[model samples]
Target chain A: MNLALHDIRHNVSRFVLTAVGIGLLLMIVLGMSGIYRGLIDDALVVVDHIGADLWVVQRGTRGPFAEISRVPANLEHRLRAVPGVASARTFVSHNVQREHLGKPLRMNVLGLAWPEDKGEWVNLIAGRPLGQPHYEMIADASLGLPLGEKLALGKDTYTVVGITRGMVASSGDGIAFLTTRDSQAVQFDQSGEAIRLERAARVQRVRVNDVGRIQPSFIERGGGPSSSIPALASPMVSAITVRLSPGVDPAAVAAIIAAWPDVSVHTRDGQEQLLAYGMIDKARRQLGLFRVLLVVISTIIMALILYTLTLDKIHDIAMLKLMGARNTMIAGLILQQALLLGALGFGIAWYVGGFVFPKFPRRVLITPDDLWGLAGVVVLISVLSSLLGIWKAMRVEPNTVLS
Target chain B: MNPPPDNTPAIEVFALTKTYGSGNTEVVAMKDVSLRVAKGEVIALLGPSGAGKSTLLTAMGLINPPTSGRITIGGRPVLDGPKPLVDLRAFRRHHLGFVFQKANLIPFLNAVQNVQVALEINDVPARAARRRALELLDYLGVADRANNLPSALSGGQQQRVSVARALANDPNLILADEPTAALDSHRGRQVMELFRKVAHERGAGVIVVTHDQRSLDVFDRTLEMEDGQLKSSQKPD
Candidate 1:
């Protein structure tokens, strides 16, 4: 029989308890890596779903998701005018949090023109698509918004028309789709009280600067005294998503759009790169640190356990040495036990993670490659951890047995 | 048991000495201790608590390096002063056997496995090791308890298992320190007589350290120690 296994068999409960502790630590390491993957997946979901050949945004901006990007809503017409441009859709997006039955829920609200076949609504699991332009919304099923239910946003209440899966923002927020017009109203419409206050503030500004007051037309040009301030007007879109005709090169189309000094353009691959490197990079770093911390903790815990266990068997080690077992043999015994602990722990963690991660609130993606990679890391840790115990065991003088 | 081919003594220690600590704290545990044991002889080491009997035994076992000594076992020089002339661990595994005060059979292994491991370490195949282990256990009269762990055996039975393990490699010399100190007088004398039987029948030399003088009759010769030095030899009444 293997000496290490025989020793562990003699104290089954202690060995099992130590393995359980290491297993729980391994679970966290796996969970941290899974969270990083889930973050990346969630970040790219909208970009992948849009299926746009190119994204056209305001000059000097990354995109609607990574930075503030705005282009004239009418820019879609000009984009369609270009050769090889199959279609262009005006898209607006921003973050929003609303209450449902007293519980707060966050969503990535997207405003877009409908009837585009660019992979939009492709993952709908329930209800009908948004048939009309106003007061209708398609929500991700993760938002837990039931179809046919009314959800309030700003001044208007929108009825849920569809529910889809896997449509989440990089931050794990659900995505909600609405007609551009309704979204504009929700985003730009001012409440009556705010409008009244803003008009008073403007009047105060006109009176203080009396030069415009001397000419009634100049004042009228600005707006009549009680006239509502012409309502803050600007570009209505966060970006323009363009689909190219088949056989059209996205780089060629993007270059043509880039010549518009007022706008910047990116092909689909560029947007994906921007999402990966620009948007989700911070989350990856945090999760990477978390994984590193878990691994370091696991190493220390295993070392402590092995060292203590070795100490418990000090006399046995001395006897073995006295009986002519070489330093290599005794060290081998300790190293073998350490490795067994890691292997058993990994087995438990992998099996439990398979069942537990899916039930987590946020997506936890444990890939096959991750399992193989982590298993290698565990083996390395086992070897390194065994060193402390082996050193101690080797130092035990065989003469101690005589004492 | 077959007799060994050579006529050389099983153990020869020349002026062995062991001292602990340094300078102000220096105290000698053994001083210029010399001894020899021929094949098939059973010798008893009798001493007081601080008489350096253990130091001498440990030095002969090749575990405790002496301050100034030369040790030869089975006609091969094994140690010079505090340094080993050969790989001491390998030499011990191949040519020497040891039994301690406490049976000291590894608690995890059963009686048979305990003996098997000793042989296995000497490059014996596992199947052959097991068969030899069973035979040793039978020779030591513990064959029925071969599968029992050390914890399950009585003190005398455990010592018998330990003796079986010591003989597993057919070593030229066996050194046992207080092998029966924990047993009652009857069991102690039984263990002492067993050592005599092991020495004569197997043609191996045996030296046992003990405080029980009642069992001295079992040894072919007796050596006593006092004040870190050997006294005159004596024969049992």
Candidate 2:
């Protein structure tokens, strides 16, 4: 340490510059690690908040939440009959962009069943749950939705009923929950002119087909659109989120539901794996590539700088060896300098990285644990880099000093 | 502390032969060279260019082991048939000191620190090392520069620092390879007389390898080498 300190003192500016270079590289790696983690955390944030153990979607699709899952509203009655089912409900969900205070705000609207039971779906932060269900909405705190503010939803305006925290969706939009009926209305209601045009088009097509014959299907004196009951509604919907009764095995429940053969069920862990290795696999891979590149760049730069420093000290080393200094002492001097560089770099990186990341659009996460881990990496690479210089120093013949 | 003075030679070399390479490229730098130096003696080694004076000093210093030789320091077998009798680095640390042509002091250290480093390498305590380093610096008339870095000192003062460093551990023998080669005539003679003072007063065996013969009178004894062999050993004018 003494000789190492002396050498560093002799070359203070050069050593500090190397530390700064290493610190910048460390900051990059820390940012990459945080980004990969944030993606996974954000993707599952909505599902994790949903607090459901299983999902029930249309038999043929992983759909709805994962892909596209839809089932008849009446299926909730049949699902109630399944063994071990405490309760079953239907919900509709979709993504929409609406003008909020003259700014575009993306909102994830979820039509939850029995708004009073929303406890299982979201944690209310400020307002109360829906008392009457219609025209009321609860927005996530991230949406910047003020209490009692009216927001346009399709052709109608819905008032913000309550505010909630941590209700983000997989796509990072703030979530707003409404009653299932309202979500259904938002999805299916058409404009007046479009409805009138659709009716005229249908009448024209019918007249062309039957001419003077009585149009029996439209002959009934029924309310508008009642005559087209079957054709007017969309049959399939997004997947369903299911929560089982206490102690019911997810695997077994999934198997019982899979008896329909087309629907797929995933356990919690399996769902996480899907998100980690399947859905966001590309993002993770990208971050991994970036981390590797950063490490390689740092190693090359540090090795080159260290080798240059060694070249500059060749005479000093030859003199040391020729003066009868031991090989360990010389090697120790080099290795100590390397370790000190790592230590200084890590200290500066931790501070600079923390300050720079929150301002970025992506969350830059650097935990104390992460800083320690980066320290380990820096030390390992630094020590390895120093080996090249140590080897060169050792190879310098002390006999050179004589010449 | 000075031990009882003895007539035994401080260094002896017998049949010291050093060769490099083999077959058609064999080059013998030193062939069967034999020489000895007694205590309290300052010997000058003079030779032409490539005459192998450095090799002789390095071989005697144990920096370079001879291919074949028997060399003793203070009656201890140091080199036996070209092999060292003890750990080469430890032996050198305890018994041999070197003064190169340049001061070669560690740049970050002052004169005293430079000398202290040598004593510290021998495991001396810090307080004792500081006192002895100061004393040696004072003896060489550079006590005022003890706190000054080698770069801050004049060329002569830096040489004094190097001399103080060489005597830090009270070694039995001191090897100086062209110690005065980089100094002016006055500074060179001052350094030569310092070596004589260190030998006679401190009872050390000093061997200086140099081509300069103008200050040969400062040496108690002098030797000349030519073509890798010692030609004469006698008292100088």
TM-score of each: 0.91, 0.87
Q: Over the full model, what C-alpha lDDT does candidate 1 score relative to the true structure?
A: 0.87
Candidate 1 off by > 4 Å: A117-121, A192-235, B1-8, B21-26
Tens digits of lDDT, candidate 1, B85-165: 999988888888998889888899999999999988887999999999999999999999999999999999999999999
lDDT string, candidate 2, B1-237, tens digits? 534334667789998888999999999898889998887778999889778888899898887889998999988988887678988778888888889898888787888988988887787888899899999999999999888988899888998898888898887889998999899999999999999889888888999998778899998878888888898888875
Model 2's i-RMS, to one decimal, reads 2.2
Worst 10 residues of 1 chain B by lDDT: B1-10
Worst 10 residues of 2 chain A by lDDT: A218-227
Tens digit of per-residue lDDT, candidate 1, span A1-403: 4789999999999999899889989998999989888988888888888888999998999888788887888899999999999999998888887778999988888776865532245478988778887888989988999999899888899999889888888879888888787777777767778866766666666666876578554444344323333444554699999999999988888889999999999888888888887798987898999899889999999999999989988888988777788787899899999999999999989988889998888888888888998999899999999999999998899877766
Q: What is candidate 1's CAPRI-style docking category based on DockQ?
A: medium
lDDT (Cα, tens digit) per residue for candidate 2, span A230-289:
545554345556778999887888788778765666666666667667777887899999
Give the winner by lDDT. 1
